[model samples]
Target chain A: MHEHQEPTPETFSTPVLSTTTATATAVAAEAAVPGAMLATPANESTTAQSLSTASQEPRQGEPTAQSNEIQLTDEQILTQMQAIKDEEANAHPLVDNSVDLTELEKEYENGSQAFKNKIKNLSDTHDRMRRSRGDGNCFYRAIAFAWFERVMLAKTKPELYTHAIKAMEESKDLLLAAEFEPLAFEDFYAVTLETLESVPTSTPEALLTAFQTDEISNSIVMHFRLVASAYLKTHQEDYAPFLEFGQTMDEYCSMHVEAMGRESEEMMLIALTKAMHIGIEVAYLSGNQSADEVNFLPFSPDTEPYMPPLVLLYRPGHYDILYRKSHCLEGVV
Target chain B: MAKPMFARRLSKELKDLAMNPPAGVDIIDANDFKVWKLGLAGAPGTLYEGEKFQLEFNFGPNYPLESPQVLFVGDNVPIHPHIYSNGHICLDVLYNHWSPVQTVASICLSLQSMLSSCTSKERPPDNANYIKTARANPKHTAWAFHDDTV
Candidate 1:
């Protein structure tokens, strides 16, 4: 992460740098531990954003002695910016280790009474929460991690693992049937399939590490997104009604479902869960005082063999993995 | 060392273009993946009939993921409402709306269609003013695609 960071003076007032890092750091510290947010390598991202703006700042007059080195082409700037985005994404672990559920409570300490009451009620059943990064891909990341972890812990029942591998293998056919080029999508499918295949021998830490890798984690999220997109495309009659007045199903899926960093809607949740036969229950947390207990939306596949649903906690725009006390596993760190 | 993703996608594109090229589009020079110049002949019935335009595509390391730098090159730049005299095209897919699924062939087809559908033969509204300040690379321009119909 340091290798990617530019050699900008930290003590100086760099507005572009400060503004971008603030949302990811200080404010996020209250919800998820301060240490985790502070650890994100964010310097390069700021410079990449404010390249044109940075040149306008007449701080201490004239240019610094290293002016010659700053000349870069638009292509160079865009590439560097892309690299910084990748590095920033890498800084935040995709799926963090489980933290006590009290972290959620701390976020709303100074807030509304409705939020307080809901948190108190949530404490009854859920023990811990694993945060996924809030990079708009949170919904996909959280669900993928939760399901992969569930597969890792199912040592006693090997068939669940077998079924998972089979489902992943067949997802390729889904992509092909949906007219996705094999050359374009095969690589993404391979990264996810190979990782899932190694799950029985893999540890929880190994799964987390794999998810942390920029290429591996994003590939899994992307492949799953394609799976969901393909499912939605093939079953247009079922989901097309949810689209806006004149928008077609393909337009909606291309803009929202298939694109990375596009926030997920309920339709995406249903399509992804139903396509993979992986049931999931999402607990919706809102500040509506009318509801005493947290609202849970369970997506169940219409089949006999779907595994017990993995849990996810949803606040306004983000998602994080939720663990119930009932989930029993032999070894977890 | 493994071949980079751009290399693989480009080779496949090169093969596809050779086997079945899009109508009125032919590659002039594709010696390497970094830059490829292709000829785009005006459609038979379009306003630009009998005119031949060259399209230059600059592929960065992030080819399919990031859009290629596409523009009309050579002396005969197209005179279309969306195309600037400087060869920078104001199209959504080439910029903000880029997706990985769109291949080189797809972009050529899009350019062909953009030319085919043209109802007028003229420069964009702010052509002279824009070309004076526009950077050599079209991607740097913060294009406001106010109109799609040309």
Candidate 2:
């Protein structure tokens, strides 16, 4: 959390000397976070400061330096501060496994009854919320984090890893059958397979660290997106009714499902979970009147004897990993 | 350390294209996986019949996630209403409509059909002005693909 905190002006002074070193340090700092990498420092203010300082040099006919300083209105300053805060939030890891649910309650203290009730319900079933960044990719990131964590915890059961690998490998055929070019999707699929296969050999600490790496994590998420897209395309007839705003299945998938960084919707979750043969329980915590008692909506319900269900906490526009007390001890006890 | 993912996918595509290429399409240069050159022949029974053109594809490190930079090059560029004199094509599939499922072969087939469906042979209306101010890469241009009736 300290790494995600906004860096003070003094912290910026040291890194400002070398742009290359600043970038390297930023990457390292992000890796230090729990699940995701730290966000890169915003270079806007630094650039603005340098330019202003350069322009402040006294000229023969120019007025005194006091007149050249720009003054920002209160509204402008507030907007700028809000923008910085948003950037800091975005830079936080895609998933934080130790976030307490009380923070969420605090966020809604001044809100309506629906929000308070939602939080109360969430607190009953979930003790902590593993936050995912609010970027459009939160759903994929959250799911991937859960999958990787499961693999690390279930290392003794090699069959789980093997099954995940088989599922990923089989997804290639689905994408190809859906008329996706093998060349376009093979790279993403291959990276996903590599990550899945490595889970058995790597230490749990190493596996966790790998997910924090942007290149590896993003590739895995991209592969999941492809799987979801292929599932929707193959079952277009079954899911077409859910398409909103008169968008054809192809148009919807192209615009939202297939495109990188696009958020997932209900149809996507259903199709993706069904395709992977894994069940997901999403506890919706929205402020809508309809949201009550942390409704646990199941995606792809399963009846397997040993299949561990993936649980997630869903707010209005974002998703986070969730852990139940009993399930968390299955690996150790 | 090495970019195995990009290299592997591009090589596989090159192999597939070589083994079975679509009609009138040929791979010109594929030694460098990051950049490729392709040759396309105008479809028969169309305005561009008997014409030939070359296309350049430059892929960034983030290759499938990001759309490739594609454009026509060489002297015999096609003259279509949606094509600029500078060899920029105004097709939606190449830009905003791009999906990760699309491959080099698919794009080539698309350009072939774009040529086949043309009723006339002419540059876009603002060809000269666009060519003058356009950046080196067509991907940078904010093209408005309003006219799909071409």
Return the clash pairs for model 1, or none: none
True-vs-predicted CA distance for residue A14, candidate 1, Å: 13
Report every candidate's CA lDDT: 0.70, 0.65
Error of 2 at B93 (Å): 2.0
- Per-residue CA lDDT of model 2 for A1-333, tens digit only, reads 000011111111111212223222332222211111112113312222321111111111222223223544434533554554345444565455456778767766566676678778777766676766544577897898788778767866878777777777778888887887667776777767887878777776676566666567767788888888888889988888777767788877876778665667777787778778788887755443454666677766333523567888764444678777667566610
Q: Give TM-scores of chain A for all candidates.
A: 0.75, 0.68
> Weakest 10 consecutive residues, lDDT, candidate 2 chain B?
B135-144
Q: Residues B37-129, candidate 1: write the lDDT tens digits.
A: 999999898887889999999998656655788999999999888888889887867765565666788888888898899887887766777
- Lowest summed lDDT across 10 adjacent residues in model 1 chain B is found at B140-149
Q: What's the fnat for candidate 1, on a 0 to 1 scale?
A: 0.05
- The CA root-mean-square deviation of candidate 2, after full C-alpha superposition on the true structure, stands at 12.6
Q: Evaluate model 2: give its lDDT.
A: 0.65
